[model samples]
Target chain A: MSATCHPSDELLVAYGAGSLDEAASLLVATHLALCPRCRAEVGRIEAMGGAVIETLPPSDLGADALASVLARLDQLPGAPMPRSPVVAAPGLPSPLRDYLPASLEALPWKRLAAGIEQAILLQARGIRARLLRIGAGIVVPEHGHGGMELTMVLQGGFTDSGTGYARGDVAMADQQVVHSPAADGGETCLCLAVTHGPLKLTGLVGRLVNPFLDL
Target chain B: MPDKRLAVEPGPGAERFSDLLSAVAQYGDRQAFALLFQYYAPRLKTYMRKLGAEDAVAEELAQEAMLAVWRKAASFDPGRANAGTWIFAIARNLRIDMLRKEKRPEIDFDDPELVPDPAPRADEVMATQQSESRVRAAMSGLSAEQTEVVTLSFYEDTPHAEIAARLKIPLGTVKSRLRLAMKRIRSELGDDQP
Candidate 1:
């Protein structure tokens, strides 16, 4: 089935072009695993990418590159092994299964506010990957971003800047965007967020409390 | 929907590349691999440079990707993808992996996400194979402004904001142009068909 809310075309193009950051690529792949139409789209983009490479002029790889590769072929394993299919939990997407803890409830979550919790998974030079859980009916602090933020909803729904995002929807925000998100009252919301930089909390109260918010 | 002018005719080198991969897969033919290595290593290096890799890094990555092709040749299916497509996919993944490696702690190479997806359905594979030259033609047909952003995006790890800064265009403009360009390409390649 196609996802109701999908990643922007540019983002998918970047992913297919292999130019997106690793964290962002992971989320995109996870979404692709669930949505067959997007997978087809990315597949087309990748094929086009390969064709683009074919038209470029060649570069030199030095004298003994082939000889070296030939010499090593004898030392490696016999045949290429097929990749084992990932057996992920019910709600967990295949791409994310390896990085996350066994189950969502088992995650080492830290309370961020009265009804919000977060668990960081990976942190690189300028990027951070984490899971956020907001209890139903809770409103998150209004905030902007220092760079780009991609939040993919895993469960339930959240409304941000007048747009309602349900499960499998990704809300992409950047420096120009500032908004508060509130979890739908029907169920708790779970989101996987990959941010390139720190989020700048907005509003007077948000500014006063920004220093205390680690996320 | 097929464009007669955009149909790709497989040349001798393309056939040779495919046969060599099959030889490597079936018989562990070092000779076949050496031939592939000679042709692909240099091309891959050039490809890497086009994607913004510096000289040494591109050279290193090209070798690494070549070695991977040798080891994984058995996994390649001529029915699914051509030699150029298969090899370039390897190079692209390796480059992305290097980017990830530099930032995070060492990644588990065995991570399932890193694995290639199963061969696409037969109809989709046919569509992709047919669309190759058409996609090329569509890319050439893009507006210069659209081409600039698309090229930078395909070449570097620049985010939308950085692309905007480099081109001195608004971020919204960059996104809109890219979206329009992609839409056109998709239409040209017959990707809009159900």
Candidate 2:
């Protein structure tokens, strides 16, 4: 199903402008793979980018610039016409496919608690992206965020504060929101989550688990 | 000396560039490629400079972007995008790779799981075709404040928060301004397809 919840227009604009950090970009790209609406939104923004470029006054390149580029054109091999399509891995979105193995079952998951497991996909520039798998009917410890946290459900669903998020839905949380999300009893919920800063666990169980969690 | 006859002037229209690009794709037309290089290389360099690249690096990246245009011309679909939009995407991807050295994972159009957009009406198809001019016209209509935010957001490498800081405004205001600007642009472009 298409996502009901999406990243804010501002966030999608940033992604279109190519200003978002790598981790955040990855999560949004994965979401775009599942949401055509956001893809169309980004396309319009990119057309604006083209308009911006068209209006920009030209800068002066070196006098030999054209000559030099022309010289090198002959040296480079001709690329095949109409570029080949990439073979996407089954059951995974195209953006996430490269970072993950073929199947979720093959992931080397690290258990954070009795029913919660996480596998970090990437960490760079203070942004961490991970796949979170919460067992059915389990409640994650109550937590606030140090900065922005973006979660997109990949499989099954979860609920927080009367809001239901199923496959392809995104949940955006920041320092102001302290929530304990529970996975639906139907199936284990698998999510791709990217966080800009540390998640602050606030509950007594969370406080106890935080010391060992390193998240 | 290079043949002076091959130097085609970049005309004052976007469709002409699209045709030139198509010629480059159909046959290895060096003259058409040269005209494109003449028009776009300098603008691409300016784009790089605005993103904080030094002169040398900007020049190199601009050249690289042009080289990529030559290599990837066959993939350019004139029905979907004009030359400027296609080249902007190329330059943006190159910046992500060469400047930031970060991976911006992309959706594969061929992926089976991808949700297809609703079929477009005949008028929607026409609007899509004229999106370049529509965007330019809409951009001209933006308020000066909205224009500044839109320009800086696209041209500068700074984050939205930084744009707020630079403008001495709150981040919320920056976001709202951008949202309003996009709304205006979208309305003008008739982009409310959904």
Candidate 3:
């Protein structure tokens, strides 16, 4: 099935141009693996970018640029040797498989609240990526973001502010957005969330616990 | 609607450059790489500067990107993308990696997820001497405003807010313009298929 919800076109274009930060790029790549339509769109966008580069006026490199590159080439690996294709695990997409634990059960889940668990994936240079597991019917604290936050649903679904996001859907929120996301009924929700900055808890209780949340 | 626009051809030197790249991949020919570098490095530096890089950083990254091209030549496929497209992608990827300020583990281009689709859709292939020409024709169709936002977005280090400020437009407007431009370009490329 096609993804009903996708990252905004601007985000995808940023991705195609290779301008997106690492955390955001991972979220988009994971979604692209599950959504063929988006994959095709990205392909076209990249092609368009290559086209623009062709028409741009050429700029001359420094006189030694080619010499420097050629000199460095000898120290670096030469041509890529042909190798067997990597076999991906059953459920995880090839890109995501690299970051995740061996299996769902192998995750090092840490308790953040009742019915809520989190596993920090990668944190570097002011950006953070994590996996969150919220039991069915659990409500995450209502909060706003300091910067951009991208949440990609990996399993089951979640609902926030009257919108339902199923597997492979992305929920993009920023400082201007404030809402409590609740896991949909039945299976627990597994989501990969990446944030550029810390979140600001909204409600009074949330604000009180905010100091401890460190999210 | 198949518009009556004729395809724009890539410059005369692209095929020879492609052959040079193939030589580098097959035999690690330094001379072939030097020829390819002479043609692309300057252009890649210009491309990087347009994306807001300073001259020194742009020069460094252009060299680094070409080095990557030398190392990854075996992964390049002429059937999937032209030499211009392949070199452009290498530069663009390097730009993004530099902006992130953290060198990620070396990404393998041969990964299935990373490879461009091996076959182009029949209608999307332009009736031109070079595949890159069709893409250029499609880009030429974008409105000036749309093209402005698109070009600015390629500056990997510049945030959307900075782009909006530079263009004297609201941030949301920049995003909306980019959205519209991308859709039009996609259609122009004959990628409107469902």
**What C-alpha lDDT, on a 0 to 100 scale, does residue B26 get in candidate 3?**
75
Candidate 3 ranges with C-alpha deviation above 4 Å: A71-75, A79-89, A103-108, B1-23, B26-32, B103-130
Instruction: Count clashing residue pairs in model 1.
Output: 0
| Top-scoring candidate (lDDT) | 2
Better of 2 and 3 by lDDT: 2
Query: Which predicted model would earn the best DockQ?
Result: 2
Model 3: how far residue A207 lies from native, Å: 3.6
Tens-digit lDDT track of model 1 for B1-194 = 22332233334235456767777777777666766776778778888887678899988899899888987887777765667667877888888778445321222234543323344457445544534465567778889998788777767665677788888989889999988887777776643433
Model 1 chain A lDDT-worst window of ten: A80-89
Model 1 residue A93 distance off true place after TM-score fit, in angstroms: 1.5
TM-score to true structure, per model: 0.82, 0.92, 0.83
Best TM-score among the predictions, by candidate number: 2
Candidate 2 has a TM-score of 0.92
Give one digit per residue, the lDDT tens place, for model 3 in B1-194: 22211122224435456666677777777777777776677778888887778888888888888888988898876655667777888887777677556432223434564433334444324323236666677777888998888877766454577789988999999988888887776676654444
By DockQ, the better pick of 2 and 3 is 2
lDDT of 2 by residue, A32-139 (tens): 988877877787787888878878889999999999999998898865533223443355677888787656667779998889999999998778999998999999
Superposed Cα deviation of residue B85, candidate 2 (Å):
1.1
Off by over 4 Å in 1: A78-88, A203-208, B1-23, B26-32, B51-54, B77-81, B99-131, B161-171
| Per-residue lDDT value at B126 in model 2 | 43
